[model samples]
Target: MIALLIRDLRLALRAGGGFGLGLAFFLILAVLVPLGVGPEPATLALIAPGILWVGALLACLLSLDRIFALDFEDGSLDLLATAPVPLEAVVTIKALAHWLTTGLPLVLISPVLGLLLFLPADAYLWLILSLLLGTPALSVIGTFGAALTVGLKRGGLLMSLLVLPLYIPTLVFGAEVVSRGAQGLAVNTPLALLAGITAGAVALLPFASALVLRINLR
Candidate 1:
């Protein structure tokens, strides 16, 4: 399981597709925000938190299929099922690898994108911090969505349908943290709520992903 995690992370990093695609999606969203909401700097700042949160959510969506699609196609997934570790452990590792590849870079780069959106100076730190705290849960949740639809021909859309609604609370509180911070208000309430959601997802998603993996492997 650890081996699989290492392999996936190395391949994703070397190929650059994981980070490239996610960042591109994030950048595209950031670029579009001004167009959608008008170019006034104040309006841009007003909406920046929501924009970043939405971009991050969609970026999470964009790379989600890769979590298990390549392995399932190449038969590594099949081999993984027969390995000694628990499927849940394997899924957890895969989720972690996916987060490292697709999410960590996004979190790391979010501040730059936040600046592009005219985000308030005060909120910039919270934006990056919120993503760092919240995005692992996005990957963890995305893995379960990936597992549920790994083998279906039309799974991609279904994966979005399944996982996006689950992302709402994280999105809400994550953006709220930045929004509050921008106004020089109390930020911890929403930030703490976002953390709670992440903890809940991490604790629960692997087991759920494992259940679906078992069903798919059958």
Candidate 2:
């Protein structure tokens, strides 16, 4: 499992732009948002939490296809399926790698982006906390989406379509955590809910993803 995790993380790093692409996308969103939404700090502050969460979610989405596509194409996935490691474990490790590479970067950089949106000072920690807890769910759900579409040549659009609806709950609760914190409202409920979603995804989605991948491979 450790080897698989390292292998995927290394592949993601060495695979040209995959390593930085999501971070770049997040940065670009942060830059373009102010221009598109006008210079009103008040308006920016109002929407800042949602914008950051949405951008991070989309950035994570951008890399979902690559989660399994390279291995599927090169036949490594076939080999893994036959190896001793359980397919569910493989799926879980892949999701973990994706989160480490993509989601973690987005969480680390979001605080800086929040400033550009005039995010309230009090909300920074909440934004970071929300992202830390919520982004794992994105990766796991995205892996399921990827597994479902891995056999298709043109799966990127289809994967996005499949995953976006599933992402709504995470987005709502995650954005709410920060938005409520920014407004000085009680954020405990949303934060707890976001953690629950993440936990549920981590526990249940890997098996579903593995089942989908095995079916696709067969």
Candidate 3:
């Protein structure tokens, strides 16, 4: 599992391997939103949590198709499936790698983007915390979506369609945590809900992803 994890990380860091694409997309959203919404600090602050969470979610979605598409195309996924390691573990590892490359960076840099959105002082820590807790679910659910469509050409659109609905609960609770924090409201409930969603996705989605992947491989 460690070997597979390392291999996916290495591949993601290579040229055209999607290491920075999501981050770049995220940065672009951070920059463009102010222009579209006008430059009022008050308005920016009002919507910052929602904007940032949505941007992060969409950025994470941008690379879901690449999770297994490359390996499946090149026959590596088949080899992994036939190896001693369980396909469920392979799916879990890929989700972990994807989170490391895409979601972790987003979490680390969210504060910088938050500044652009004039995020409230109290919300900054919550924003980062919410993202850290929630982005793993994005990667895991995305892997399941990717597995379902890995064999189709132009599967990116289909993957997004399939996965966006699954993302709503996370998005709601995650953004709620930040929004409530920004308002200095009690955020324990939403924050706990966000954590629960992530835990459930991590524990259960890999099995579903692996099942879909096996079917696709056959």
Alpha-carbon runs more than 4 Å astray in model 3: none
Winner of 1 and 3 under lDDT: 3
Choose the strongest candidate by lDDT: 2
Task: Show model 2 residue runs off by greater than 4 Å.
Answer: 15-17
* lDDT winner between candidates 2 and 3: 2
Judged by whole-model lDDT over C-alpha atoms, candidate 2 comes out at 0.96
lDDT of 1 by residue, 126-184 (tens): 99889998998899999999999999997999999999998989999999999999999
- Candidate 2, residue 75: how far the Cα is off, in Å: 0.4
- Collision count for each candidate, in order: 0, 0, 0
Flag the better candidate by lDDT, 1 or 2.
2
Q: For candidate 2, lDDT tens digit of each residue in 85-201?
A: 999999999999999999999999999999889999999999999999999999999999999999998999999999999999999999999999999999999999999999999
True-vs-predicted CA distance for residue 200, candidate 2, Å: 0.6
How high is the CA lDDT of each candidate model?
0.89, 0.96, 0.95
Error of 1 at 58 (Å): 0.3
